[model samples]
Target: MKLYDHSVTVSSKRLNLFLKEIGVTDIERVEVNVREGGNLAQSYQDKSVNGKVPLLELDDGTYLSETVAISRYFDEITPNDLNLFGASTLERAKVEMWNRIVEIDGIQNAFQAFRNLSGIYADRENCVEAWGEEAKHRVELFLPKLDKQLGQSKYVATDNYTIADISAYIFVFVAVNALKVDVFETSQNIKRWFDDVSSRPALQN
Candidate 1:
């Protein structure tokens, strides 16, 4: 299998981190330079209709797009390994719930704010300052809820670290690096959870 990757993007990073956490190292990696329009090129577009990075090409030449879908594929292939999704029905539901929350409230908002505010994405998409400001505000409003959730559990979904934690970590990464927000100061629970997640050897890479 081969992974078409762009290291700088949050979605790609989340996928990469998930792969690492699951101890997947045998797959070949092909880097895509989004800044150079590599992802939008005709060849890549043919492989991924969305023209996005982090496309996983299976040995049979099947292509998988979307970070969550890719992660789910990995989980399905290695069901008894790390159990990143969940081991039980209730655990799976909770994991999916938290993952959706992090995606909708955290990652999506933070990414929108970054895309609209940063000059780096100007060539890729039109930037709107008003939209950026609104997205940033939405992220800020959602942080406390995230903090409260983290306060209740060691990880996002359950006692074990899972895909939800990966999603939240990437969102926090974008919040700090792209939005230029100091989230650590506003939420001690998030800060504690983030510190623990960051110390993982898989994330250090």
Candidate 2:
């Protein structure tokens, strides 16, 4: 399997974390930098084209896009019984719920914040200051929710860990690193939980 990715991107983090968690090691990693104008990078986004980083090209010539889809594909390839998704139906639903929230509140919010605030995508056509400001406001709103949740539980959803943690973890990293969010001040419990998860061998690398 060949995994296409780029450094510091949330999609890249998702693929890498899932691959490491699943013990997938036979991967041929390909890096694509879509920072500005990379042909192969644009191809991946336009599915009809041959480009997209974080795309998984299977040995059978199948091209897989989307980070979560790619991660679930890997899990199905290895073992359908893994607990990363969930052990029970209810647990799975809860995991999915948190995953959705993380994708929306964390990933979406962080992306807007980074692109607008960091000048990373400042020169892009659709980039606007208003969207970035709104995103940062939303990010501030999300921290309290996470802090409250973490204050009550060890993990995001159920009693055990799941892909919810993985999704939320990577996005939080982006929020702190790229968006310059001061994670510790706004949410101590969330900060503690993030610190614990960030130290995991799979993430620290």
Candidate 3:
């Protein structure tokens, strides 16, 4: 299996962190520099219609895209190993729910703020500053609610760490770095949760 990777993208980071957590190291990595328009190349785009990183090439020439789907595939293949999605049916649903929430509310808005305000991807797509401002404001509003949730639970979905943590951690990272939102400084619960999650060796790798 080949993992088409982009070092800086959030999906790449998520997939890499997940693989380490699941102890799957057999898959080889192939770099796709999106910033250089490598994903736009006809050869690569032919296989990956979406032209996205963190794509996986299965043994029989099946191309898998999307971070969540690719990670789930790997998790399913190694049923005996630790499941990052969850261990039980209900827990799996909780993990999926929280991950989707983080993706839609936190991660999406942060990316919107960055793309519009920073004009980083203005050439590739429309960068509406007004909408970007609203997006940033929306994430800022959502942070307090997230912090409240973190105050109650040690992890996002279940008692143990799961995929929701990965997704939310990415959101916090994007909030601070790209969106320039004061997440850790303002939200103590989130700060504590971030510190706790940061201590994991999986994140460092």
Instruction: List, residue by residue over 1-205, the lDDT tens digit for candidate 2.
Output: 6777786667787778877888886778876776754524345656414354577788887888778888888888786455888888999899899889988998888888778766665444467788888998898789888888889888887778788889888777887877778988878988888888878777766
Q: In lDDT terms, which candidate is top? A: 1
Candidate 3 lDDT: 0.86
Which stretches of model 3 miss by more than 4 angstroms? 79-81
Candidate 1 vs 3: which has more lDDT: 1
Write the residue-wise lDDT of candidate 3 on 139-165 in tens digits.
999899889888888888777799899
Clashes within 3 Å, all models in order: 0, 4, 0
In candidate 2, stretches whose alpha carbon ends up further than 4 angstroms from where it belongs are 39-52, 80-82, 122-124
TM-score of predicted structure 1: 0.95
Candidate 1, residues 71-171, lDDT tens digits: the string is 99987886356779977999989999999999999998998898887756788788999999999999999999999988999999998899999999999
Model 1 CA deviation exceeding 4 Å by range: none
Compute the lDDT of residue 97 as modeled in candidate 3. Answer: 87
What lDDT does model 2 reach?
0.78
Candidate 1 weakest lDDT stretch, 10 residues: 74-83
TM-score per prediction, in order, is: 0.95, 0.89, 0.94
Q: Which candidate is the best by TM-score?
A: 1
Q: Which ten residues in a row have the lowest lDDT in candidate 3?
A: 78-87
TM-score of decoy 2: 0.89
